[model samples]
Every structure is written in C-alpha cells, then in structure tokens.
Target: MSTLNKVADVVPELLIGAAVDVVVRGSDSFIGDVLGVESRYAQLGWLAAINVVVWIIESASEYAAGVLWRGLAQGIEHDLRVEAYDHAQHLDLGWHETRPQGTTLATLNDDVNQLERLLDVGFPAILQTVLNVVLVGAVFAVASWQLTLYAFLPIPLIVIGSLVFQRRLEPLYDDVRERVADLSGALSANLSGIATIKSFTAEDRERDRIAGFSIAYRQANLTAIRSSAAFVPLVRMAILAGFTCTLLLGGWQTLDGDLELGLYSVLVFMTQRLLWPLTDVAEVLDLYQRGRASTVRILALLAVPVAVPAGTARLDKPVGGRVELRGVRAGYADGPDVLHGIDMVIPAGETHAIVGSTGAGKSSLLRLVLRFDDPRSGEVLLDGTDVRELDWDSLRGSVGYVAQDIYLFSGSIADNIAYGRPDASQADIEAAAEAAAIADFVASLPEGYGTWVGERGVTLSGGQRQRIALARALLRDPALLVLDEATSAVDNETEAAIQSSLRRAGERCTTLVVAHRLSTVRHPHRIWVLDAGRVIEAGTHDELVAQRGSYAALWAVQTGEATA
Candidate 1:
C-alpha cells in the first residue's frame, strides 16, 4: 500500500513532464494563428483537456503522498517507542541502580516523541521536493541545454546550501536533543518526587532547577531555528538570481529566434517550480536533522547490551536450600569495595540473620546471592552452583526475596499475592496470606483478596505492605528465602507476628534475614556482624553475644543500652 501510494505523485510528475513537452510543441504553432486550421483547433482543444486532467492528477497524487508518508512514519515511531519501553523493563537491577530513572524515561517519552513530529512533517516535504527537482530539471534540459544551463545555475547553490545546513544543523540538533532530554529528566524527577519537594518546602528550589533545564532547551532550539530561518531568505535571493538569469537570457534567445516562445515559457515555469521546492527542503532538513539526533539516542538505548544474560537453570526443587558466599569481593562500578574477600556458608534449614550499621554492606550481600549483580571477585553459590551461571529466572524462581522497600504492583490483593506465583489458586493465596498473618485483614476488606492496592501498594499501611510483600514471597514457596529489613518499619506486634512465621519457614526453605532491630533476629541459629565490608564476627547468636563484639555492640545500641 505504501509503495503504491508513493508512486501516485511520481507517476503524475512523469505524465505532466511528457504532456508539457507535447503542449509546448502544439502551442508554438497554434498560439500564433488565432484562426488556425480546423484540425489544429481540434488538437488545441484536446491539449487543453489534457492539461486540465494532468493538473487534477498532480493535485490528487500530492494528497495521497502526504497521507501515506505521514501514516507510515507514525507507525514506525510508535513501534520504536514500544520496543524501547519493553527493553528497559527487562534490563538488570544493576543498570537501574547505575543510571537515573529520569534519564531513561526521557529517552522513552520525549526523545521518541520528537521523532514522530519530524517524520510527520519532514519526510513528505522531502519527497515532494525530490520529485519536483527530477521533473523540472528534465523539462529544462529537453528545451535547450544552453537555456537549461542558465536555469540550472542555482543547482549547486541549493546543494551546497543544504549540505551547509546539514552540517551546521546536525550538531545543533544533537545539542537540542540533549537539552530536551535534560529538561525531560528534570521534569520527571520533580514530578515523581513531588512529595519530597513539598515536605522539604523545596518547591521553589525544584522549580528553579527545572527552569534551568527548560531555558537550556529553549536556547538550543532557538539556535537551531536561527540557522534555519536564515536559510529561506538566502535561498530566495539565489532563486531570484536564477529567475533573473532565465528571464534575461531566455528573452534574448526567443527574440533572436534561437528558442521557441512556448519552450521558453515552460523553462521559466519549471525553473521556479524546481528551485522553489528545494528551498522548502532546507527547512525540512532542519526537522530531519533533529529527528536523526533524537533517533540516535533512542537507538543507543536499544543497543545497550543486556549485562545479565539469560541463564539456563530453572529451579526444580531445593531440598536443602543452602547458600554460601566464598571469597566474595564486591563493589559497584564507582564505589569502594562493599564486601571484601568474605567467606561464609549457611547450613540447610537454618535461619541466619545479619546485623550491621549503616553502609556496612549487609544489603549488597543479598544482592549478590540473588544475582541482582555479580560480585567483583569470588562466587555466590546457591545449592552448590554459582548463582551467576544459573539461569536468572530459575535462580530467582527458587528464592523468595522481600526487599527493605516492599514493592507491590497495583492490583487486587489476590493479584499482588500471586505476583511471584501467578498460577497460585485462591486457596494458595489465602494460605500464603495466613503465613504472613494478613489473611484476616484480607477477609475484612470490602472485596477481600479482590481489594485493589493503589500504585506501589500505597493504599496499605507500612506493616500491611510488608506483610503483602511477605505473602507474595511465601506464595512462591521457593526453597531459599531472603527477608531484607523485614521488621524495620513495622510495630512490635506486627514484628512478632512475622517473626513467629519465620520460625516455621525452616521446615521448607533456608531463610536469611537482614536485621536492624535486635529483637526480631535475636534467636537466629547464626548471626554475622558486618563492619566496613568484612565479617568481623560470626557465630551462633548466643556465642556472638558472649563475644561482646560488633554484633553485640549493634544489639546494645538498638536495645538502647548504648549510644552509637
């Protein structure tokens, strides 16, 4: 359909070119004799009819070309946007951690959107200009090469001007694209953190921050527009020069009987049509250059390699659910080592707890075992296999993780609980809820498990959100479990309730908990005290307490028996 539609305008251009040749030949003889012979009059009438038909054909083709090109361009734009979004979500947690969410969002939304605007207006203009050039240049060459040479004097100027515009505009457009992305990033960050802005009474401050980016973007666009605006008047002057050359030179040829009057008329009309159309291309090139800049960003985003390749292992069963980290040297891309040459192992069916002060690398430890990121050196092993080598889906499927910040996709209670175990039945969901001690609360809801939790589970209390996240993990029934900061934000009663459930978790899977409050993890079979990225002490909770070291110190501090 698109190719056929593209042919529409081009076909008429050919027809018009051929008709002009025939019309020039006919008009030369009949135009002179007002009382031309009968057969000649008949031919003149037919030529008039042919001219009318060609005009209609040209108009219809142009309309068709506009619709087809614009529609196809939009389709391609939307496809790219959807693909970028899908790929971004599939990327690793490490990628998200390293880059700002606002930047990626800007590429997906604003950058892709810019391409659509360019394609919608710019591509059709290019097509019309190209066809006009071909048809007009052909007519000029056929009439007289000398006259054609004079008419064609501006060809190199148009070409040179477009090339100059392209070079100047390409980088200007790139800067414009970057500025737009910066503005979008700033806007997105402010909007997402609007609550933080309000709480700090930093609304004015954020507004200033956004205004800075907006001004940069506005200035960048103005720079590009300024270049493009100069293009027209300059091209118009060149066009005028070409037209003056044609008028002065062609008039001499006609008067000297060197060229026919009708052919001269065609040359003048064709030259104006050809050169005028090209001037519009300069403006269209501006749009095309901008779109090219925006597309490169989008394409670069798509080109980002998936750092964590898909693994082959799928969790079939974890009989023991043991975990071990051996010679682990871990750090992020820019940071100092968070964990250094750490060796530790958890026996199957044991509930191990980790305690540490701020920036002690406790959470980073779990991330390695979960394969959210690979350790810089050494191995994170689950069930005797390096977690990195295991299929990500399989490794993750076999382990249930509830992070410090409990996350829930917006959905009904049943939907959120079934997040990890999508195939779980209502009975399974209720059972998982019971395990987390939120089943009764679910029953009391106006819609029970069908109750809708707003975005990120905002409708639920902190404790409720934690339990829902817990239930979500429990529903998966993975052989290994990591409860990270499970009891940090909950009340004592809720903590106790969740703790009671943890005591029973050992029957099925080995569980590791990252503990901050002392009471929740007091009875773990093993407790490891981490300080400045090393395991300074590790033993049974009772033994660690006897040592009166870092773990004991943290315990005392949390229990209010000591300061810091």
Candidate 2:
C-alpha cells in the first residue's frame, strides 16, 4: 500500500504529460471548428496551458523519485557492506585460512555495489514504469474500451519475450558473477604476491593467468549481453506491432462510427506512451536477476552459521591459573598425533619450560593450550576446569599468550600495546614496556609511546616488535603466561632485563616458556624435552646435561659440545 501511494504520486504526472499529446491531437482534430470562433480558440489555448503544467509535474516527479531511491540505496549499501565485513571477522580462523581473500573481497565490494545499482536506478525506474503503464492503460479504458483492448493486443507478446530473456539471462549473469570473483581473486593474489612473483621471475606467468581470468569474466558477460541486447529490440518490435494494430483497428472503428473522434486521439497517443517504455523492462529484469544473484552470495557469507558462539565467562575468576594437561591426545585433521597421552601438572605458582627441536610441536602445544584449536581428545584443565568448558573470553582472558611470530599492528605504540586491554593506565603501559626492555627505545623516540608503527610494525626492528608484543601481553597480567621465545629476538642486554622482569613475574604468576635457547631457562623450576610428540626427558638443566639423553644432546649442541 505504501508502495502503491508512491506510484500514485508518480503515475499521475506521467499520465498528464502523455495526456498532453492526446489533448494536442484532439485539439488539432477540432481546430477547424474551434478556430472558427474566437472564444473556442481561447478555450483550446487554456487547455494547452494545462498540458504544459502537467508535463512539468511529470518531469519533477521523476527527478524526485530518482533522488529518493539513490539516497536509500546508498544507506542500504553502507549497512550491508559493514555488516558483511564484521560477520566475516567474527568467523573462525579456519574460515579465513580456507577461503580465498579475493573471493571474499569481490563479495564484499563488487557484489554489494551491484545491489546498489539495482536499487538506485533499476528498481525506481521499474516502479515508475509500472505506474506509467497502469495509468496510461486506465486512461485508454476510460476514453474508449473498444480501442484500449485492441491497442494492447501485442503487449502480451512483448511481456512473453521479456520473460524468456529473463529466464535465459539469470543463469548467464550468475556465471558472469562467478567469473568476476575469480578474476578479482586472481588479480588480488598477483598484487599481494608481486614480490614473490618477481623473486621467482613469474611475472609473465602471473600476467598470463590474470589475462585468462579476465577473458573468462569478459566471455561470461558477453554471453549474457548477447541475449539481453536482443530483448529490448525484440520488445520494441512487439510494441510497434501493437501500435500498428491500434492505428489500423482504432482507425477502422472510428470510420465505422463505433468510436468518438476525441477518444480516437487518446487511443493513438496512449498506445505508444503506455507500452513502448516497457521495451526497457528487459533491461530492468536483467538488473534485478543480477542483483539477486549477488545478494545470495553476499548473504551466504553473512549467514554462515556462527562457528564460535560467544561465551560470557569473566577473566578474573579462574582458580589461580592452576594449569594441567590431563591425557591430552591431540592432532590436526587426518594427521598423526602431535601430543600423545600427556599428563602434566604445574602448581599455581611455579614456572615450567618446554624445550624441543623444530617441529617438536612446541608452538602447536601453545595453540592447544590457548584454545585456538581444541585438542582432539582429552582436556586442557585450568584450575581443575577443562578450558573448553570455560567461556572462551574467560579462559583466554586469564591466559596471556605471546606467540613466537610476533605481529604488531600498524598504529600508535600505545594503541598497539593496549590492543587487548584498552583501559590500561599510562603508568601500567610504561611498566610493561620497561619490563619488556623496550622502554628506552620508546622513550628515545620523538613520540615516545605515541610513535606510529607502520603496517605490521614495519617501522620497528624485529626485536623492537617482539618487545612491544611482550609489553602488550604484559599489560594483560593473566593468571597463566605462555611466552614462546619471548626474548628470542632481543639483544643480550635486553634479554637480561626481560629475564629480570620474568624473574619478578615468576613470583606473581605461573610462566610456561617454550625455548631452544638454554640460557633463558638457567633457573626454571623444570625443563621438559619433547621429540616426536612425546616427552623424552624432564629435569633441571644440570640434571638433563648429566643424563646425556635428548635434552642433554640439545643442551650439548647449544653449548657447542654437539651439533645434532
């Protein structure tokens, strides 16, 4: 009904404009008799004035409808694009890892844009056209039913032709959309990997590949365009046929005296005015199908089931971060187990270190503990509670994990450090920086903590990024701290300072370190060695060196007694 009212506002003006032509035709037919009197000429001139006013109203209505529709379309586009991006971020890590960045990019940017085009232009015009058609047809009916019915005889043929083209074009546009995403993905990958492409001297190869993708996209569009291009012309022909029928049938009817002369003028004008614009309905239907296809792809992303349902557990309520691994037998999908039937316990206030070689699954172990990926079997217990059973927010909140591959976001140093906990005070942030041994570097900078790090902290050195990451993790003050080579990139001097901070942190919280560098663990309460996903040995550093096992072998290699 609301839609109907908008149509009512739009249609009357279009009808009036179309009716002006009818009025002119009628006045011309009666001109010989009317012009015979000065008073009749004056009356005819006044009707012409009314027709001019109606034409202006019609133009104004179309302009208003276009403006209103465009504004609404922009709003809708903004909301949908933002919503899709936000939902994509909330999805699980596997989704990002598995999905093509280019495909997702195309869905968010290109597909959303397609919707905007349809809503702004195609949709508004469709409504206005419908209003025009209905109103003009209604006018013809009122003027003379005999002529009105006869004039629209070929309209059904035009409509049928439109539907046939619509059915054929829908699937073609779907193919075009897929090809566009493919081309977008290929282009995005090439751009992002330009350095790799150059290093491997694969630039020519990549260009050829992108050319193939673009050609496919073009071909898909051409296929649809081939069909869509024919439709408007075909529809126009059908309309021409209808107009011819109206000219012949209405002319004959008037000659036979079955129709009044004035109404014949209305029928002649209304036949073309009412049905001719419908030739463009083919183009409009094409836009609609394309928009709908793009929408389905976009909403599919939006509607991906919430993989990780949110939990409301608080960070402050863990049981002193008492950490335990109870028979955790875990592995990746279809892969051999990385952690086998492991049982370990760390009292609430002790520091433990796990040392292993490359692929010793040290990092994988941290991933399991952090609940980034769950253990295939068994549980990671926190304060006698399985971490999985705990709310994700609460579990990760109480556990501060600083990974080996440090990533510092591009932002102010203060913002990067406070990424997790926003309300951390200035002093607290400084203390964290001091503990991580990057305080001097930060203080020496012109902006202090206000310095902006370039993308992924490219502005900072590797060691500086590491320290900043450590500082960021330190601000969390979690119950359990897992630092995987937390001081690996730092200089010896910085290492000592971080050690001092870790020594102090030792008394405050349980620390788990995964390191190959024995120098960092001279004072750890215990050191566990893992090989082939099983713990090979466990003891103090002195005890492990004395035992001459896997741990001693690693210790000897680090101390220069053995290389393997």
Candidate 3:
C-alpha cells in the first residue's frame, strides 16, 4: 500500500510535464505520439482522465496504509503492556522491594506508548519518504542526467547532518526518559500518601518536591528539543540549494535547446517533492531517538530474570497443614540474616502465635513460609514437603495469608471477600465474613455487600479493611491460615470477637499468628516469644507466666503488674 501511494504521488509531476507537451507541441506531444492521435483536444482529454485515476489511487492507497500501520501499532502496544505487567507480577518480592512502583508503571505505560507513536506515524512517513526519493530521482535521471547530478549534490550534506544530529540526540533523549520515570515516581508516592501529607500539613512541601522533578523533566526535554529544532532549518537550506540547481541548470539547458521544455518542467516540480520530505527527517529522527530510548528501558525490564522460579511438584489434595522451619537463615537481598538458624514447627490443625518487638524477624519468617523469598540455608516445609519443590499454585492454593498492611481493591464488600475464591456463592461469602466477625457491620450498611470501597478501601476504617482482608483469606478455605497482626487495628471488643472466630477456624486448619500485643496471643495453643531474632521462650500463656522468662516479663508490663 505504501509503495502504491508513493507511485501515485509522483504521477502528478509527470502529468504536469505531459500537459506542457500537449499545449506546446500539440500532435507532436508524448501522449499523442503514444496513442497515435493527431488532435490537440483528444490529447488534453487523455491527460485529464489520467489525472483523475492517479488521484483516486493516491487517496485509496493512503487510506489502506493508515489502517494497516495504526492497527499494527495498537496490537503491539497492547501485547507489550500486558507482557511487562505479567512478568513484573511474578518477580520475587525482594526484586519489587528494591525498585519504586512508579518507575515500573512508567515502563509499562509511557515507554510503551512511545514505541507505538513511532510505529504508527514515524515509520510510515519514513517508508514513504524513501520511496518518494527513489521514484522521483529515477524520473530526473531519465529526463536529463546532467540536471540529476546537480540536484543530487546536496544529498550527502543532508544525510551526514541527519546522522550527526541523531548521535547528539540519543543521549539527550535517554536522559529525558529517565526524568520521566523520576517524575512518575514522585507523583505516585505523593498521591498514595496524600492523607499523611494533609495530616502533617506538608502539602506545600510535597508540591515543591514534585515541581523539582517536573523542572528536571522539562529541562531534559528542552535540551533535546533545541538540538532537534536546529535540524529542520539546516535541512531546508540543503533542500533550497538542490531546488535552485534543478531550476537554474535545467532552465539553461531547455533555453539552449539541449533539454525538452516538458522535461525541464517535470524536473522542477519533482525536485520540491523529493527534497522537501527530507526536511521531515528532523521530526522523524526525534521520534526515532525517543522510541529507541524507550525500547531499551522496556527490554531491560523484560530481561530481568525471575529470581524465584516456580517448581514442578504438585501438592496432594487435602493437605495436612503442617508447617516446619528447620535451621533456617534468611534475609533480604545482600543483607544480614534476619532469621538466624531458627527451628520451629506447628502441627496440623493447631494454632501458634509469634510475639516480638519491631524488627524481630517475625514477618521475615512468614515470608519464607509463604515462599515470597527462599531461605539462605535450610528448608521451609509444608506437610513434610519442601516449599521450594512444590509448584506455586499447589503450595499457595492451600495457604491463606493476611499481612500487617491490609490491601483491599476498590470494589464492593462482598467482592473483596470473594476475591480469593471468585466462584464462591453469596452464602459462602457471608459465612466467611461471619467467621471473620465482619458480617454484622457489612449488613448494617445501606448498600450492604454492594457498597463501593473506593481506592485501597480508603472509604472504610482500618479495622474494617483488616476484617475484610481476613474474610477474603478465610473464603479460600485454605489448610494453612497465616495471619500477621490481623487484629492489630481492631478494638478490645472486636479483637475478642476475632479471637473467638480464630478458635473456630483453628479446629480445621493450622493457624500462625504474629502479634506485638501479648493479650492477642494469650489464648493460642502455644506462643513463641522472639527477642532480637532468636526464640527465647515457647509455651502456653500459663506455663510461660509461671516460668518468669521473657514472656512473663512482657505479660507483667501489659497486665500492670510491673512498671517497665
């Protein structure tokens, strides 16, 4: 289609040359000679008919090229965005923690869009420009090779200038892409923390910080723009020199009877068509550089190896829910081990609680059990099978986890509860909500389960979000239920209600709880007290209290038996 359009585009210049032949030479014209016609009127009529056909072909081929190129660009953009996001989703939690969320988003969105722009618009224009130059140059060569020599003299200058500008713009555009990611990161962080900003009355400070990022982005773009802008004027000058050569040299040859007047006219018009498009090289190069920089970033993201690859082993149905950590030592990337050779076990259908101060490796232990990160040494096992050897779906399917920070997608109350089990019935969803001690509150809302929770469940209180997360986890009917500070946000009454619910839940599944409050762990079947990443005490509440160890001292301070 693009080739056809370029062919059609050059026909008008030839028609102008043919029209000149008809008016000047009459029966001796090229069209009349080709058709064996001897009349001037008949020759003019043929020229008019040819003009209409060429115009139709040009318009039709233009339409086809637009549809095909734009469609291809859109399809590729959609596929790349989806693939990048899916890859990011499977990456290890450690990898995700090392980068900012907004930088990843920029690669998936803004960078992908840049490539689309190049394919949709820049690529087609470049293709047609090359075709135009070839077709038009061929005509000039056949008409008069002497004129072609003079007209093509400026070609080298244009090509060299374009190459020079491209090299300079490459680094500038790369800097531009980095600034874009930085600005996106700043905006995303500010928006997510808008509530904190307002509470601390730091809105102006945040605005100034964002302004700094924006300024850097704008300056980076300006630097590239200045370089790209200079390209067009220099190209136009080269174009002007070529046009003048075609006009003056061809005119002198025609006047001296060395060149045909009809051919001379064709050379003048075709020179403009060929050299003028070269001016657009600047704009095309700009798009090319930006897209090139974007492509590098997108490909880099796709090339990152999946640090925690999935295993091939499948778990047996009706898992026993037994979990064990044997001589485990683990930490985040390149950091000291948070879990220092720890050994622990929780039998099937039992409830175990881990109590500790901040940064005591309570959460780190949960991460290993969940396979978010593999332990540096030893093994984490589920039902006597190593977690690293189990397929992700098989291992994760049997486990349910609620983290310290609850995340609820923007949806209805019932939708959030049914998230883990999308095929769950309304009755089953309500039952899980009841088990989480949140059914009554959801029932009191005017919209009931259909209520909109807003982004991150911001419309609900912290306790409500936590309870909804718990309900979602419970709805999975997992054999191993992991709760990390699940009741930390709720009041005493609500905490007691959740504890009662946990007791019922523990009857059929293994439950692991991590808590800072001693009261929350008092009723568990067993409690492990961790101090500075080491387990110092393990027993039931009464047994630990009687031992007068770390758990006893913590309980004494909580119960007001001693001043800490």
Candidate 4:
C-alpha cells in the first residue's frame, strides 16, 4: 500500500510536465500524437481528468498505509511489551534482585514506545523517500539521460553522509537509552518510597536525585541531537548541488534546442521532489537510531536464560507434601552460601518450624523449597521427587507460600484473599479470611468484602495486609503451606489467633514456618534452629529448651529471661 501511495504521488508531477508539453507543442505533444487528440483544449481536459484519478488513488493509498502502519505499530508494541514483562516475571528471583525495577520498566515501556514511533512514521517516511528518488530518476532517465547524470551527481555524497551520521548517532542514542533507564529507575524508586521519603524529610534529597538523573538524560539526548542536527544541513548542501546542476544544465539544453522545454520543466520539479526529501534524512535517522538502540535492549532482556527452568514432570493428584533438602548448598549470584550442605526433612502432614536470626538462611531455605532458585549442590525434594524435576504449575500450585514482606494488589479485600483461588466461592474466601482472623475487620468496613485495599494495601495496616496475604495462601488449600515470618506484623492477640489457625491447618497439610519470634514456632511438631547456614539444633521445643543449645539461647534472649 505504501508503495502504491509513493507511485501515485509521482503521477501529478508527470501530469504537470505533460500539460506544459501540450501547451508548447499542441498536436506534436506525445499524448496528442499518440491518441490523435490534437485540440489543446481537449488535451488540457484530459490532463485534468487524469489528475483527479491520480489524486483519488493517492488519497486512498495514503489512508490505507496510515491505517496498516499504525495498526502494525500498535500490535508490535503490545506483543513486545507483554513478552518482555512475561519473560521478566519468569526469571529467577536472584536475577531480578540484581537489576532495578525502574530499568526493567523503562525497557518494557519507553523502549517499546521508541520502536512504535519508528514503525508509525519513520519507516514510511524512509520508504517513500527511497521510492520518490527511484521513480523520479526513472522519469528523468527516459526524457534526458544526460541531464539525469547531472541530477543524480550528489546522491552518492548524500548517501555517504547519511551512513556516517547513522554510525555516529548509534552510540549516542544508546547512551540516551541508558540515561532514560536510570531516570526511570530513580523516579520509580522515589514514588514507591514516597512515604519513607516524607517520614525521613528527604523530599529535597530525592528531588535533587531525580533532577540529577533527568539532567543526565537531557545531556545524552542533547549530544545525540547535536550530532543528528548536523546531518540535515550537509544533506541540504548536497541536495542544493544536485538541484543547481539540474537547473543550469537542463535549462542550457532547452535553450540550445537539445532538450524539450516540457521535459526541462519536469526535470526541475522532479529534482526538488527527489532531493528535497533527503533533507528529512536527519529526522528519519534520529528515529531509526533510537529505535535500533531500544531493539537491542529489548532483545537482550528476552534472551536472558531462565535461571529456574521448568521441568516436564507433573505432580500426581493427592500430592503428599513431604519435603526434604539433602546436602543443599545455595546462595545468590557470587555470594557465599546462605544454606551450606544442610540435610533435613519434613514428612507429609507434619508441622515444622525453622527459627533463625537474620542471615541464618531461614528464608533462603524456603526459596530453595519453592524452587525460586536451584540448589548449588544436592537436591530439594518433594514427596521423594527432586523439585527441579517438577513442572512449575504442579510444584507451585501444590505449595502455598506467604512471604515476610506482604504485598497486596490494588483491589478489594475479598479480591486479594481470593487471588490464589480466583474461582473460590464467597464462603471459601470468607472462611479463609476468618481462619486468618481478618473476618471481623472486613465486616467492620462499610463495603465489607468489596472494600478496596488501595495500592499494595496502603489503606490497610501491616497486620491486615499480612492476614490478607495469609488468607490468599490458605484459599489455595495447598498441600504444602510455607509461611516466612507470616505473623511478624501482627499484634500479640492477632498472632495468637493466627497460630491457632495454623494448628488446625497443619492437621491437614505439611506446614513449614520460618519466624524470628520463638513464641510463634514453640508449638510446632518440631523446630530447627539455624546459625550461619547450618542447622545447629532440631527437636521438639521442650527438647531444644532442655538441650540448652542455640535455640535455648535465642529463646532466653527473646523471652527476656536473659540479656543478649
């Protein structure tokens, strides 16, 4: 369609030239001689009819091209953005931990928009410019190949200059892309931490920090723009040279009776049409370079190997929630092992708690079991099957996990509770909320289950968010229920209620709890005490207290029985 539009666009110039020919030569004009329409008035009328048809074709083709290009741009933008986000979501936690959220977001949003801009306008403009040159040059060649030589003399220089500009602008635009990502990252971090910024009275500091990023981004753009701006003037000079040669040489031929006056006029108008668009090369190159840079980033993100690859094995129905870690050594990228060759097991339907201080690898153990990261050595097994060999849906679907830092989506309380089980009945949602001890609070709200939680449940208290998250997990009715500091945010009363709920829940499923507070894990079937990536003690709470090991020491400190 764009090709058709470009071809149609060149017809009017030919018609104008033919009109001149008819006026100058009458019966000798090519259309008059060939079709035997010798009357000059009739030739003019024929030219007018052809002009209308050409305009209609041009208009229709332009409209079609616009719709097709814009549609293609939109489809590509949507698919690429979704693909990048989907791939990012599946990447291992360790991979995500090393990169900034803002940078990733910039790639997904800003970079994709750049590609859209190129497709929507830049690509069509480039295609039309190339076609105009070829189509007009063909006309010039047929009428006067001698003048064509002069008309196209500067094209090589324009092409060479464009290439040089494209190469120079590539690195500059790449720098611009990086700067934008930095700006996005800083802005995103500041917005998400706006409350912290206010509480710390660091608004000015954050503003200045973002200003710094913005300034860097502006500088990068200016550098690319300065280089890109130089391209047009140089192209214009080349175009001027080409146009001048054609005007002088073609006019000389016409005066010398070696070229037809009509053909000379055609050459003049077509020269401008062809070389003038070359001046727009700068803008097109600017878009192309930016889009190219964005494409590189997008492809790089898409190419990142999934650190935790899914397996082909599916968990059988009636999953036994037996979990075991055998000689498991795990850590983040380039970090010392957080869990060092630890061996442990929780039989199906047993309730176990892992109590450890910060950096003791308690949460790290959970990550391994959940298959967020593969063990550096040995295996994390579920029901005697290595977890790395289990399909993602089967593995994750079977285990319900509530993290230490609770996150609730922007939606109703019921929506959040039923997040893991979206099809869960209202009775089930309410029951799960009731089990997490948040039912009374929901009922107190004017909207009840439909009450909005706001962004990340900002309208709710820490305990409320935690309970809502726990309810979301319980709604899944998972075979293995893992809680990492799940009750840390709650009050003593709420904690007691949640513990009571856990006792009942443990009766039906394998439960693994990680907690800093010794009281939360005291009543579990067994407790494992970790210190420096090693399981230092494991036994019933009373048995550990009787042994007076690391668990006893921490228990003493937490209970205020001793000063630590």
Question: Candidate 2 clashing pairs?
Answer: none
Q: How many backbone clashes are present in model 1?
A: 1
Mind giving the per-residue lDDT tens digits that candidate 3 earns over 1-564? 999999999998999998898889989999899999889898889889999999999999999999999999999999999999999999999898889999998999999999999999899989988898799889988988887888887788989998999999999999999999999999988999999999999999999999999999999999999999999999889989999998998999999999889988899999998899988899999999999999999999999999888888887888989999999998888888888888899999999999877888999999999999999999999999999999988899999899999999988998899999999999999999999989999999999999999989999999999999999999999999999999999999999999999899989999999998888888888898887778888999999999999889888988999988
* Separate clash counts for every candidate: 1, 0, 0, 0
Q: Give residue 487's error in model 4 in angstroms.
A: 0.6
10 residues in a row with least lDDT, candidate 1: 1-10
The weakest ten consecutive residues by lDDT in model 2 span 29-38
Best by TM-score: 4
Compute the lDDT for candidate 3: 0.92
Candidate 3, which segments miss by more than 4 Å at Cα?
Answer: none
Q: Write the per-residue lDDT of candidate 1 for residues 12-48, one digit (tens) a residue.
A: 4443433454455654454324434335456556556
Q: Write the residue-wise lDDT of candidate 4 on 1-564 in tens digits.
A: 999999998888888888999999988997797668989999989889989999999999999999999999999999999999999999999888889999999999999999999999899998898898899989999988887888898889988888988889999999999999999999988888899999999998888889999999999999999999998888888889989999998999899999988888888999999889888889999999999999999999999999899998987889989999999999889888888889999999999999888889999999999999999999999989999999988899999899998889999998999889889999999999999999999999999999988888999999999999999999999999999999999999999999999889888899999999998988888898899999989999999999988889999999999999
TM-score-superior candidate, 2 or 4: 4
What does the lDDT read for residue 295 in candidate 1?
Answer: 90
1-564: candidate 2 lDDT, tens digit per residue = 324444444444433433443345543434424445334445456556755665566567656666778889999999999999999987766577678899999999999999999998788768767776677778777767766776677678877877787788889999988999999999887876776999999988888998999999999999888888888787777788878888898888879988755666667767877777787787788788889889989989988976545555444464487788888787765778988876778778789999889888777778777876677788877787777677876787777777888887779999999987999999999989888888999999999999998767878888999899888888898788899998898888888999999888878888899997988887888888878777788888899889988888777888898776
| Ten contiguous residues with the weakest lDDT in model 4 | 27-36
Per-residue lDDT of 525 in model 4:
83
Candidate 4 local accuracy as lDDT?
Answer: 0.92
State the lDDT at 497 in candidate 3: 93
Q: How do the predictions measure up, each by TM-score? A: 0.88, 0.85, 0.98, 0.99
TM-score of 2: 0.85
- The better-scoring model by lDDT among 1 and 3 is 3
